[model samples]
Target: MQFRLVKIAETSKKKQTFIFLAAILLALFTTGLFIMFLGHDPVKVYLSLVNGAFGSRYRIEQTLIKAIPLIITSLGIAIAFRMKFWNIGAEGQITMGAFCASYLALNYSYLPRPVLLSLMLLGGFIGGSIWGIIPAFFKAKWGTNETIVTLMMNYVALKWIIYLQYGPWKDPAALGFPKIPNFAENAILPKFLGLHIGWVIALFLVISVHIFMNYSKKGFEIAVIGESVNTARYAGIEIFKTIVLAMFLSGGICGLVGMIQASGVNLTLSKDITGGVGYTAIITAWLGALKPHWIVLVSILFAALVQGSSYIQTAFGISAASAQLLEAIILFFVLGSDFFAKYRLVIDWKGLSRKKENKL
Candidate 1:
């Protein structure tokens, strides 16, 4: 007998939902077994994780703080991915954006606080847009591989920021400590009722992206391009223009996250400012299936994992590797379940019959 996999014609929404829930439950169950093997109560560990992430108003705010950058960066990633553009350079764009915003905050301290903040936003956006444009321009003109170019750009941007932090942009008054000068009061993002305004911006962007992708002409063009380049060309969609524009918007949004991270949280620029958000947000974008609102939910779930991981280390006395293990296990199950939902196993009757006849 031979076995093979076949694609399903269609999957019902209910089945997809069930599959998603099953994946989550299976991940939890497997993780629980691992915890049990460690001589710890899995239920207690999970409850502790929930409490640590959302047991209080303060915890919720912290989770939201983490989610804000993920949300913005994921939205940016979703835009490029929607058009079949693999923009893996969000990290570089983020670093460059923060650097631009910090320049204004550090040297242009005389400007009004509100004005400084506005200019910082613009600077960050432009900086990120430029980084995105570099690879995209080459890809459009020369048919170069965007994935490699974008990935290489990430290292370049990262090194540039490190040099600035340790070199020309380093603060001289810190008594030899390698750090940049802090932003002036006006450069910082204001908090509203204990949370930074970045949340507000994130919320607005969520709605805007949904509308743009679902209702706008440009969005439809992007969708077509994603489906097939040949079809897009035949439809006269101006492939070059669409690619460049989409990448610019995508990188620009990622750059805004840099500004938010600097202004709202760190209030300074450093080599570690991005904290791997660019990469993490890509997961959020994919798990959310490139949907703006869906990305919000995925971001919250991921933020919880992050905020809770520290507590797991403290309470369980397990290494940080445990948290990573749990994350990997969960991702594996989720993707595996999705694959089953899209395909089914079938017996190869022709091969099975031949084998039976041979045996006879």
Candidate 2:
């Protein structure tokens, strides 16, 4: 018998929810087997993961800090994805944003705190927007493959940061070490409660994106373009303008993550400022189905997974590679479920019979 795949035109919300939950359960079960293979009790390890992520106020705060960058970067990615534009340059955009913000912070240390911080934010946004626009312009003007261009730009941005860190921007205070100077007090973000104000910014962006994507005119144009460029043009939507604007917004939001990380978490610009959040955000954006509200939930869950994985390394003596493997397995199953939700496998009896007849 031959096997074939058929797309499901539609699935009920309840069924989709059931499939999602089942996927998670299956993932957990499968991961448990792996844990057992490693001679650890699965149930205890699971509990430890939960505790590591949210057992106490401090743990929860740390999870939130991890989620902040994920949430912001995912939102940016979702915007571009909504228009079917593959923006893989978030890492570069983020680096450029931090570099731009640091320029102002390092040079204008004499400015008042609020003013310098605001200028830094603007600079970060502009930097990312400019990076995003480069790919958009090429795609709009010459039909360039955006995915390749954006991916290549990421390395360019990384090298730029590395050059600055080791060359001109190197802090002379460090004795023969490559490091950028830390941001002045005026450049750092203030904390609200125990966490930096980034959490508040994340929440604000979540609400704003939901509104923009669902209620705004430009949002409608983006959706239409994603569906069909021809349809969008027939509907009088400006394809070039929409693509560029959407990407501008996407990259700028991602840039904010850089600014927040540099100013709040690292307190200085570095080659590792992104911590691979740009790439991770793509997973969150897709898993969240490109929805702003859903992105928040997905980002938080992902953050918890990362935080818990780190904790298990110390708490249960689980090696880092094993913990990472556990995460990969879970993500694989969960992503597979999304595919199954939209399609089904079937035995092609007719095709098999025809093949047998031909052989006979």
Candidate 3:
């Protein structure tokens, strides 16, 4: 008896409704306890969070700033998940891409803006693809554990960036800081009005990937493989090829995200350049069920929570660390909702009647 990925079966309407209600009640009750412990009103805190997230144009922009990167990287993550491939190295891949873009921007800042931008993006794609393909290749050729390989590679990337900042890539003007120089005018991406044009690029990529995964024959092959690797083999699908392609594309996309965040926002590279977008994107993928449209909604919602955390710090005399508790709570509920929506937990399996077994 081997464990396997279960394709959660559809349940009756009544059961579906019950699960939905259960998920909501569980989230609310848990959050309520947290509020009580903190000596805060749960309803007031919830309202404050929501208002802080959507209260003004500035807040909206901040939310988009968070959501845009998530949308792009999570889409890449979603692609691999669809093929049942766990690619957890998007963070390293993103860092490598940022490293490449930063290096090029520093060296070739004299080039025309359009050309420099294009090259930065290309550098990002290549850097990320190379990083992504390593683990994928080993997994395909030698049946190596991709999860371990990718996780280890993240530290490698982190150390590489650190070495550069401390040695060759150090900015002369920054006396002691471990950071790169401000990108040249040509090295920077354009801002459309106030919003980074990179957001537009992210939006287009989301739509394009959505269409690619849903309408393309290659997409069907991925879904088949995810459903059953044996079925894919029986259907003559090249499993290794799929793994390599998916991982490459996944890493490449995350790499692009790195470039955009660097050139479009940070405008320089730091050791901790990627922040936590890599991990957060995974949550976005799961919350979205790898669906393109749903991903958008979930990303924005999560982004709102992030923004709201800051608001709580400012308006309610709460520490940022404490505000983060609310975010964790929300994420737990969202993920838990997905679980309940899919699987019915039998807490007391032996107590179930034979009729329930027949129903399941």
The Cα local distance difference test for each model comes to: 0.89, 0.91, 0.83
User: Which residue pairs show collisions in model 3?
Assistant: none
RMSD of each: 1.8, 2.5, 5.1
Weakest 10 consecutive residues of candidate 1 by summed lDDT: 318-327
Give a tens-digit lDDT track for model 2, residues 235-323. 99988999999989998998988899999999999999999899888888987889998899988988887888788889999875664
Where is model 3 more than 4 Å wrong at Cα?
1-9, 12-25, 322-360
Instruction: Write model 3 residue lDDT over 62-163, tens digit each, in one string.
Output: 888878888888898898889877888889999998988887999998898999999999999888888999998998889898888987888999999989
Q: What is the descending lDDT order?
A: 2, 1, 3
Sorted on TM-score, best first, the list reads 1, 2, 3
Worst 10 residues of 3 by lDDT: 1-10
Question: Which lDDT tens digits does candidate 1 get at residues 72-171?
Answer: 9999999999988899999998988898899888888799988998999999898888888888898888889989898898899989988988999888
Task: Give the lowest summed-lDDT range of ten residues in model 2.
Answer: 320-329
In model 3, the number of clashes is 0
Where model 1 places Cα greater than 4 Å from the true spot, the runs are: 348-354
